[model samples]
Target: MSLNPIPNQIILLLLESYNLGANINLAILMSLIWNDLFLLFLSVRNIIVFFGPSPTLTKPLRL
Candidate 1:
C-alpha cells in the first residue's frame, strides 16, 4: 500500500511558512488545508459505509 502524502505536504507547507523572509500566503495555505481535510472526511465516510457502522468507534446500529 502506498503511503498517503497529505501529511507530508502539510508539514512541508508549515516548514516553508517558517522560513526566513517567506511570503506566507495565508489564502493558499488555508485553502490547501481545507481541501485536504474535506478529502479526508470523504474517504473516512466511504470507509464507514464499506465496512458497516458496527466496526467504527461510534458503533452506530446497522439497519
Candidate 2:
C-alpha cells in the first residue's frame, strides 16, 4: 500500500539523512531531528485525542 503525503515526506527525509552520511552539516541535521520530533508529538497527540483515555489509566484511587 502507498503511504499518504505526510508519511511519504518523513520517509524521504529519513532517506536523505542516510544518504548525506558523515558529510552532513550540523544545521541540516538539527533541522531534521527537530522536524521528526515535532511530527512524533503531533501524531501522539492525535492518537490520544482520537481514542480518549484508557480505562485502566483512568481508574479512580481507592481510599
Candidate 3:
C-alpha cells in the first residue's frame, strides 16, 4: 500500500502547535481540520480503488 503524507504532516504540525502554547481553541481547530482532511483523503482513495479504470457513472450517485 502507498503512504499518505498529508495526514502525517498534519499530525506533526498539530504536535508542534500544541507545544507552542496553551492555545486550546487553535489546537482543537487544527485537530478538526486534520481529521476532516484525513477522512476526505481516505474516502477519495476508497472510491478510486473501488472504481479502477472504467469507473461506474451515475449522475445522481456521487462519491
Q: Show where candidate 2 strays beyond 4 Å.
A: 1-24
Q: Is candidate 1 or candidate 2 better by lDDT?
A: 2
Instruction: Report how far residue 3 has shifted in candidate 2, in Å.
Output: 61
Which number leads on lDDT?
A: 2
10 residues in a row with least lDDT, candidate 3:
53-62
Give the poorly placed runs of model 3, Cα more than 4 Å off.
1-22, 53-63
lDDT of 1: 0.82
lDDT tens readout by residue for model 2, 1-63: 875899889998998888777456766788899999999999999999999999878999778
Report clashes for each candidate as comma-separated counts.
0, 0, 0
Listed in order, each prediction's TM-score against the native is 0.48, 0.54, 0.47
> C-alpha displacement of 55 in model 3, angstroms?
9.7
- Expressed as tens digits, the lDDT of each residue in 1-63 for candidate 3 is 977999999998998887776577779899999999999999999998887644345345657
State which candidate, 1 or 3, has the greater lDDT: 3
The better candidate by TM-score, 2 or 3, is 2
| lDDT value for model 2 | 0.87
In model 1, which regions exceed 4 Å deviation? 1-24, 55-63
Q: How well does candidate 3 match the true structure in TM-score terms? A: 0.47
Cα-based RMSD of the predictions, in order?
Answer: 16.9, 16.5, 18.3
What are the per-residue Cα lDDT tens digits for candidate 1 across 1-63? Answer: 987899989988888767733545666788899999999999999998998777566767689
